[model samples]
Target: MIASVAFRNFKALRETSLILAPFNLVIGPNGSGKTSLIQAMVQLRALARLPLRELMPDDERHPEGAEITFRFQPPFDGLEASLSCVSESLCDFLQVTPLSTGGGVDDWVGLRARLLSLKSYRFNHEAIASTSALKDGGELAPDGVNLAAVLFTLRNTNPNIFECFKAELLRIQPEYDEITLIEQADHTIALGLRLAEGAEVVPSDNLAQGTLYLLAILALAFDPEPPAIVCIEEIDRGIHPRLLREIRDLLYRLSYPASTGDTRPSVQVVATTHSPYLLDLFRDHPEEVVITEKHGRTAHFTRLSDRADLAALLEDGSLGDLWFSGILGGVPDEQ
Candidate 1:
C-alpha cells in the first residue's frame, strides 16, 4: 500500500505531504484540496498509460509545473516514484517520468501495473443502472457502470464471496429482501432489488440512488481482482446518516484484514467526505483520517492522529461536533 505521498506546486497543494493509512478518510470543506489530492493519485495512475501532455496540461493555477513523490511501505519499502512536470504554455513543453530507485525493471513494471490498477470512484447512478454488455468481470468501472456483469461473475464464480457480499449489503439495507440479476435478451445483465420474498424485482434503474451506490461499493470490496488503491469522492452522498457507519466499516474492511473474516488481498482505500457524521465514525481510527485546510492558494494536509492535543480535543465534544464547530482546521473560515 502507498504509505505516503508528497506534493509540490500541484494545484492547491503548493507543498504538502500526507501519510496514508490502509484506509484514509479525508474530511474538509469545499475547495480545501481534497479533490486535488485524489486527482494527484489519478494523475499518477494515468502516467502509467497516458501521455505526459495529457496528464499535465498547462493549468492557470500552476503554470510553472508540479511534482508528486510517492513513498511505499514494506515489500516496496525502498521503492519510490516521483512524477514531475515542467510546462511552458507558449512552447507546450511537458516532461513526465517515474524516477524509481532500488528496484529492477520487473519491479518497476509490477509497480506500474499496480498504479494503473488504482481506481477512483464517483458513482454515476444512471450509468450504474444501465444494462451492461456481456463481458468478463472482476473489476468495477470507475463510474460504477457494468456493475451487474461484475456481480453476475462473482455470483457464478465465487458463490461464497457473493453470499458474503449479499449479507453485508443486506445488513446495511435490511429493507431489501434479495438482490436480483436480470438477464437481457441481448446477453447482457442488469441489477435489481427485491423488496419482499415474493415481490417483483425492481430494476436498478428504478432503485434508489443509495441502494445502487451501496451495491457498487459492495461489489468493489468483494472483487476478487481488486484494484491496488481505491479513491472515493463524496462517499456519504445519498446515504443516510445512520447507515454511514456501515459504509465506513465496508471501506475499512477493504484495507484491514482484522476488520472482516474474509481472506483477500489488502486493497488500500482513500475516501473524501463532507459529512461530519462520517467524520465521527473515524474518531477511533484517527490515523486513517486527514484534515485538509486551504489558506490562500496553498493547501495543507494534517493527519488527525498526529495532533498533539488530541485528548483535549476529544473532550471538547464528538469528533464531528469539534470539526463542525470549527475547532478542526478543515472547517471553512467565515470571518
Candidate 2:
C-alpha cells in the first residue's frame, strides 16, 4: 500500500503529490489523474508477470497527458513495481532524464519496492528487491489482477496466514447468506456465494462486477501482512447502492485497530468513486475523504470533509438524502 504518491512528468501531472490513507475516496472530473495515479501503482505490481520493456503506449493512458514521478510508502513495502524501459518508443519524443531516460546494457525493467514505510522510512534505491529479468523492481505482478494468482499461491504456502485473511474478508462480506470455497482441476480455488433462494457455488465472473470489485477490495483485507496504502481505480463502478455501505464498513473495520492480542491487516485504501453511496458511508472518516478536480491539464485534490451543513445532513442517516443535499455538489445518478 502507498501512504502518498508523488507524480513527476506523468500525464497532466508535472510535479504533484497527494497524501493517502486507508479507505480513501478520490472523486474528480473525467481527465483528472485518478485512474492514471492508480495505474501508476498498477504498473508497479504488473512488473512481476511481464518484462518492463514490454510495456506499450496503451499502458499509460488513462484520460490524457504524461506523468513523471510517483512516491509512496509503510516507508516502503517490499512489493514490486514494473514499467517499460524509458528508452522505448513511448519516449521517442521525450526529452528524457539522467536517472531513467539514458540507455545502457542495463536496459531492463521490472518491479521496485521500498522496504520502509514512506511516513517514517527514508528513500533508498537499493532497498528494492527484483527479478533478474528486469532493471525495475517491486512486488506487484503483471496485469495487476494477477494478484489473485499470487494470493492463491501464497495461501498454499501459508495456510495460517491465508485463513486469517479469509476470516477477515468474510467478516466484511457478511452480507452474503452463504459462501463456499471450491477447488478446480487446475488446482485453483474460487469463492462462491449463495443467494437467498438456493445454495451453490457462483463463480466470481458470474457475479456482478461489483462483487468482483468488492472481492478485489477484500483482497487488500486479506493481505496477511497489510500494506500502508492500497489504491483502487474505481470504488463504485458496478455495485448496488445498498451494498456500498457494507463495503465502506468493511473498509473501516479493516482499518480499525486490532482487538486485544489479535492481529489485523494494517491496510489503507485509496479509491475513486462517483457513487454518493460510498461518499455518504465514509463521510465521517475525515482523513480518508479526497476530491479530485481536472482543471486545464492537471488534476488536484479538494476539500470534501465533514463540513458544518454536510455533517448535519449526514446525521439524517440517509446517504441518498445527504447526496441530494449537495454535499458532493449534486444528487447521485442512481441510474
| Candidate achieving the largest TM-score | 1
lDDT of 1 by residue, 36-113 (tens): 888778877876675434344445335456777787756665566666755311112223333355333336566667
Candidate 2 all-Cα RMSD: 10.8
The CA lDDT at 58 in model 1 is 41
| TM-score list, all predictions | 0.88, 0.57
Q: What's the CA error at residue 61 for candidate 2, in Å?
A: 22
Per-residue alpha-carbon lDDT of model 2 for 80-101, expressed as tens digits?
A: 2323334311222211112322
What is the overall TM-score of model 2 with all chains considered together?
0.57
The regions of model 2 sitting more than 4 angstroms off are 1-9, 14-16, 42-112, 115-178, 186-191, 194-199, 203-205, 253-265, 306-335
- Give the alpha-carbon lDDT of every model: 0.79, 0.49
